[model samples]
Structures are given as C-alpha cells and as structure tokens.
Target: MASSLATLIVSSSFFVSFILVLQLSSFPSCRADVGTAASYSAPYLPSACYGREATEFPSSNLFAAAGDGIWDNGAACGRQYLVRCISAAQPRTCIPDQSIQIKIVDYAPTATTLVLSDKAFGSLANTSAALINIEFQQV
Candidate 1:
C-alpha cells in the first residue's frame, strides 16, 4: 500500500508539471510591437503682439486699448480657445481677425509671442497667426 501511494503521488506530480510546461510553451515567446510616435509642428507665431514688447494683461482691469489677438480659426492648436475667456465681462474682439484675449497666467522668456489658454484665445479674432488685436470693456 505504501509503495502504491508513492507511485500515485509521483505520477500526479509529473502530470501537473507536464501540464504547466505545455501551457507555458504554447504561448509565443516573441513579443508584439506596440510602439507609437506623434509629430507636432512649430508653435504658432503670435504675430500681432510679437514685435511689441512683452506686456502684462490682467483680468481685474478692463483694458482694451492694449493690442490683443485671438487664435486663428481652424488653427491646429489654437482651437483650444474656442469660446472661453479669462473673465466673464470681456467679449470676443474681431479686429485683426486672428486675435484673442490671453490672460498672463504664466510667463515665457524665449517666446516671441504670447501664449493663451484655448478659451482666452477664442475670445479674440480667429486666426492661427502669432498675433491679433484685442478689445475689451469693463462690466
């Protein structure tokens, strides 16, 4: 009986090991390629405000005389500023077509043009050029 039990145990162990090996071998050893790459164009030029020195535009003050522009319509990246503004009182300006009102949320040292959030960019004229004229009124 003891010998018989040992034989059964060994057979079961071998069967289990064989099944595991078969399962592992059935899977392909080679890995599938799942890599991807994305391409981006140069940043849009804020042409309207480019030559002008860097100026600060704050939300608290209703300043329109200052030159502000919006992202151009159908701009690849400027679409972000479709219909949002830094402030509610400020309306979208249409002069110089590609202009938007961009609040100076962050600063850019090497940037020749100003950067605006999608919403703020949408508040000015629509264009993809670097710059556009902006107008504003206090509510």
Candidate 2:
C-alpha cells in the first residue's frame, strides 16, 4: 500500500506539471524591447495623431503617449503594446508578473519612452516612480 501511494503521488505531480506547461504554451510569446516609462494624467487631447477632435481614451484606462522613437510619423497611433515593469530606481517599485496591454492614443515630445496613463502605470508598478525600466512587446 505504501508503494502504491507513492506511485499515485508521483503520477499526480507529473500530470499537474504537464498541464501547467501546456497552459503556458497557449499564451502568445513575443520579443520584448527594453525601455523607460512614466505616468501622465488626463488632458490627453490634441494628440499628435488624432488632433483636437478625437479623444478616444480606452474605457479600460489602459493607454499611453508614445515618444519620438515610437511616433513613427504618426503611424503608431493605434498600436497596442504589452508593457511590464522590469526595474525601477527604488526597490519594490515594480509588481512582479504584472503586465498591461495599452493603446498608443497620443504622443509626447518628452524624453520618457512612454507616458502611460495613471491607471495603467499604477496597475503595473508603484506610481510614485517618475520613471521605471520596462519590457514592451507590440501586441
């Protein structure tokens, strides 16, 4: 009976590990780029891409303002990126395993690579940080 129980436990463990691998494989994986980001508040109107008439903030409040590197001459207006906080000046500023899908609704002439909305920034990391290292992949 002891040997039988051991066999059952090992089999269950293997089965659970296999299932986790399968589930993880189903998620799309893409190459990520290292960059820096900061948070910005509302008044995102008169954006470089949309002009004064358009103010379509995603209801999710997950949006960002692109920098010159990603402006792409206004071509990156509606691009969606999956952003994750990788590091920060202060420890514990980043939330582990947290990422958010955000739309580029505007552009910023500022130096920050991305100016994420308040909600978006807070969701991934501590908002008190003026800047944080990020890993981003276009999704």
Candidate 3:
C-alpha cells in the first residue's frame, strides 16, 4: 500500500508538470497571433511616416549658392540630407509631396533648378531630376 501511494503521487506530479509546460509553451503563440492580427488590421499605420499629408512649409530667406557649404549647388553638401518644402503654393513641386523628410547624396543641375542626388531624391520624390522647389534642413 505504501509503494502504491508513492507511485500515485509521483504520477500525479508528473502529469501536472507536463500540463504546466504545455500551457506555458502555448502562451507565446497566442500572443503572436494577437499581434499579427492587430498588424493586419492596420497595415498602413506602420508606413504612415512615408505618407504625411500636404502642409504648407514656411519659406526661409536664406538661400545658399551652389558649391557653398549650405547649398553647395550639389557639390559640397553632405551625401545625406532632409528637405522640406517651405513654399505653400508649389506643393506638388516636391513629389511624394506629403511632408516627407528625404536624404540627398548626388547632384543634378538643370537650367533653373538644382537636383539632389539619386538617393536623396528617392526619399522625397519618386522621379529623378524633376524640378521641385524644396527647402532643406540639415540632419
């Protein structure tokens, strides 16, 4: 009788331990499923940064010449930058016009306007060398 009682207790303890382990293991999957469902419901929320609405950017009087430290006309400027459109009337001039921060690396100079490097242009506008009026704030 004593041996049987000990065996029963051991068996019950083992079953309880196994059940606890299984419950704990399932917790992570349940949490993950909830997170995935939430993400699927609002897919655009994560990309909201890339789709800011159009807003008027205030113009600054300071205009740097090409090759100057500030403007550099695409020569001396840093390989990366953030450009914000200050002009309200010329909103579409900056494609992806929604208030976006862009990085600039290369230079393309045209008749009336100077263009940012390809990488920089990609941040703000999808088109390359397209004329767009923008004011840049160095990051």
Candidate 4:
C-alpha cells in the first residue's frame, strides 16, 4: 500500500508539472510583439486617486497602466510616455500622426498591453475600440 501511494504521488506531481508547462507555453512571449492597449473609464477605476503610487492624480488628464512585465517594480510609476496609434484590427481605424502623452499610474502585468484611461486613449484612437495596436516611447 505504501508503494502504491508513492507511485500515485509521483504521477500527480508529474501531471501538475506538465500542466504548468503547457499553460506557460500558451502565454505570449515577452518581446516587442507590437503593444496593444485598451481604454478604461471611471467605472473601472472608481477613484481618481486609485493608482499604484502617486501623491495625487495629476491634472493633465492623461495616464495609463503599464503592462505587468513593463511595470518593473514601479519604475514606470508617474513616468510620462508618448503613445501613438500604429495600426488596428480590420473594421477599426488608425489615424496617422495620432498620438498622446500619458503618465503611468497603474500596473497591467499582462504581457504587451497597456491599459489607458479613456481620456488618454481617446486622445489618440477611436474611443469605441476595445483595443488598439500602439507604439510608445518614454518622453
């Protein structure tokens, strides 16, 4: 019985490890895969003061949530980046020369995606889009 129990435990451990590997493989690789962004409104961020770390939300009306990997221990917090719409999925649009300056206020720890506030997103892309491909550089 002890031998049988040991075998069962070993099998379970192997199965769990295999599953973890499969799950991680399905996640997007961290690289310059062309970042994307989605807009969030006041409803998603109820408080204007709700940010990773800021004495008070800035009055510029521009802010975003850095992606999980890019957040980098809050190194991006309060940092301004210039974001521009590069391209969009069909049935959507991308305006050349469309750009906006945004400050990082939250974390988006989910690969190559930035979560922008409605005001910030709207400044560059169509407000109705669920997502938009973008290129950003620290400014």
47-120, model 2: which lDDT tens digit per residue? 77677755476889899999887888788889999999999999999999999999998888877789999999
lDDT of 2 at 121: 96
Compose the digit string of candidate 4's lDDT tens values, residues 57-116. Answer: 667778888887568777877778778888877555666697778887777667656888
Candidate 2: global Cα-lDDT? 0.89
lDDT of 3 by residue, 8-115 (tens): 999999999999999989785322100000001112111211232212111221112122233354443333334544332334534444433433322223232334
Per-residue lDDT of candidate 1, residues 1-139 (tens digit): 9999999999999999999999889985643221111111223234233323333424332112111222222232212121122222224323333333323323233222334443344444343434432232211
* RMSD score of candidate 1 (Å): 19.2
TM-score ranking from best candidate downward: 2, 4, 3, 1
Q: What are the clashing pairs of model 2?
A: none
The lDDT of each candidate is 0.34, 0.89, 0.36, 0.75
Worst 10 residues of 3 by lDDT: 32-41
Scored by lDDT, the top model is: 2
lDDT of 1 at 5: 100
Error of 3 at 89 (Å): 9.2
Residue pairs that clash (backbone atoms under 3 angstroms), model 3 = 57-86, 66-73, 67-72, 67-73, 103-120, 104-120, 106-117
lDDT of 1 at 93: 29
In candidate 1 the C-alpha lDDT for residue 132 amounts to 38
lDDT, model 3, position 59: 26
How far residue 65's Cα lies from its native spot in candidate 3, in Å, is 13
